[model samples]
Target: MSFADLGLSDELLQAVEAAGYTEPTPIQAQAIPPVLMMKDLIGIAQTGTGKTASFVLPMIDILAHGRRRALMPRSLILEPTRELAAQVAENFEKYGKNHDLKMALLIGGVQMGDQIKALSEGVDVLIATPGRLMDLFERGKILLTGCELLVIDEADRMLDMGFIPDIESICAKLPTNRQTMLFSATMPPPIKKLSDKFLSNPKYIEVARPATTNINIVQYKVPVTARKKREMLRHLLRTDNVSTAIVFCNRKTTVRELAKSLKQHGFGAGEIHGDMDQSSRIGELDRFKAGEINILCASDVAARGLDVKGVSHVFNFDTPWHPDDYVHRVGRTGRGGARGRAFTFVTPEDAEAVQNVEKLTGGEIPLFEFSGEQPAEAAEAVEEKPKAQRPRRARKDEGAERAEAAPRQEAKEARSEEPRKERRPRRSQPEPVDDGWNGPVPEFLHVSALV
Candidate 1:
């Protein structure tokens, strides 16, 4: 259905059309109507399902008539991360172009003076991270009592990042009569409790299964050693004809390392993680979205709430520790009705982790062998060194002169008549060689008898 059928104002529809969205996504179709009707809403959809526009369009229409007072916004959107909050602000700019809506962003790692000035000028919409929002409230620079509408985007992510308590405190400060909307890719129990506590008679809209990956994405598992992940990623990027892709890693260290590795290999790549400064992270993302970079190596911090359209591929350098993250990581691609590809690298040790992910998604991920490649006949077949060529020093040295001379040298040194022999050597002596044929000794015998 079109935005017009969703009961949005003509101006909002015009803005949507200007933004080049002719059809509303399923989440948008189901959510906009109830939200515009001033009902509390709980929207659960996978990532890349156009969930942001589901609420942004309707809220812009509802907020068009309200006038905000200084330090008091008429509407508030609480996002779990600064990148997500900034993305929501961008949506407001795009969809609210026809309407006169003043929005201010409050997130950490930015100049507080600029945010304070914006808040003082009065904002119709306030988009903020939970921590920074609470900071402003505690300093008496922002008031929640005047808030008429509240949107908690990525509710599950907030819980994952330990922001639920902050959300609860903010909810307590806001007007209880305000319209509340909570959106997430998954609905964990804590998120449900938060929704129950804050929402009144909420309309539940779920477009996809919780923690499920998109079907449109062609997913594959690329078996490779962990140490060779970067090389394998580079090979894929060079051979797969990727247009724009996001490479997800489990750790911030891996994100940085992979991005640097890609850059050194002449790939147009950038990195984003929680450890990065806000400006650098945003700059990298802006470059990536503008086609300045073809690859973005990021942690799960970039997985949720940041919308970058036309991503053709996703590569998981490290299997996500959380299965829900696997869904979101792959969802970064295959967005906006476009078909995409996703490849995840898995080592032997990561088989159980991949199995857990498959269990969570309720399907077996197809194992993809390198084209024209076959499994080795045995473990030794895959080893670089031939078995016959492997060093046999232990067997060769058995009963050799060095072995016999070792004990004789010790005895000779111990029986020396030199007065200096009374002083013990500070250096440790060599250990006796194990014949490799005897059964393993008890731990206490090895420890006490050896000493």
Candidate 2:
């Protein structure tokens, strides 16, 4: 269905059309209607299923007529990461452009003064991370009692980041009669418990199974040694039809190293992980979206909320420990019904990890048989190469040199094998001494000499 059929206002529809979205995604088609009705909702959908627009589109209309108050926003959107919060803000700007709505973003690694100013002047919507939101609330810089709408996005990520307690506290401060919505990629036990405790008779909408891999993504696992993972990745990037891709690594160090390696190998690559500050992360992402870089090496931090469309491939440099993470890592690709590919490098030690991922996805990923000689066998074959023959006189001269040098080598070895004893130094003869004052020697000196 189109955004217009989703009960969104003409202004929002115009904005959405301008943003190049003609039809609503499944999640958006299902959730936006309930959201526009001001019902409490529990939205369960996988990543990259247009979940942001599911709420953002309706929110712009719901908040269009709300009155703003100083220090109290009309609506609140809680994201678990700075990037997600910023992304939601971008969506609001994109979809709410036809309407005039004041929006503020509160996340860490930025100046709080501007956020405070935004809050003081009163904003129609506030997009924030839980930590920064709680900090601002405790400092009495913002009030939530007047908030009429609340959206807790990526609830599972909130659980992962240990923000449930903060979420509960924030909920307690908000008006109980307000509309609330909780969206998550997976409905784990903790998030379910939080939803039950917080949401009041929420409408449950799930477009897909929890932790399920996207069917559009063709998944494969390449059996490779850890030392040859880079080689496999390079081979795939060179041979496969990769227009843009994200390479997932479990550790930030690996993300940095792999990105550097790819750049050195002449691929347009960039790196993003938790270790980078907010500005650097945003800059790298901007470059990626602008086509400055075709490959992004990232940790699991980029797995969940990042929404980049038309990604041709996803390469997992390391198998994710958490099975659910496998879903999100591949979810970065195959977005918006586009065909995509996912290649995971599986080492001998990662057998269990791959098994867990397969169990979660509910199917086995076909192994990608490397077409050429394996890395180990190729190296060994090169090392075992035969050498060319030398002249007979050269061989004879070599043998003669060794024969002549053998005795000296044996003598040196024998000397080194023997233990040496400590020797006493020889004493030197004493020299006769002459006194410079021979003519007038002191009486004390004469007595001393005689004694």
The per-model lDDT (C-alpha) reads 0.87, 0.88
Query: lDDT winner among the candidates?
Result: 2
User: Which stretches of candidate 1 lie above 4 Å from their native place?
Assistant: 372-451
Q: Cα RMSDs of all predictions?
A: 12.1, 8.6
Total clashes for model 2: 0
Give the top-scoring candidate (TM-score): 1
Candidate 2 lands at a TM-score of: 0.82
Report the Cα lDDT for candidate 1.
Answer: 0.87
Please list all clashing residue pairs in model 1, or write none if there are none.
none
What's the C-alpha lDDT at position 206 in model 2? 94
TM-score (all chains, Cα) for each model: 0.84, 0.82
Ten-residue stretch with the least lDDT total in model 1: 373-382
- The sequence of per-residue lDDT tens digits that candidate 2 reaches over residues 212-233 is 8888999998777777788878
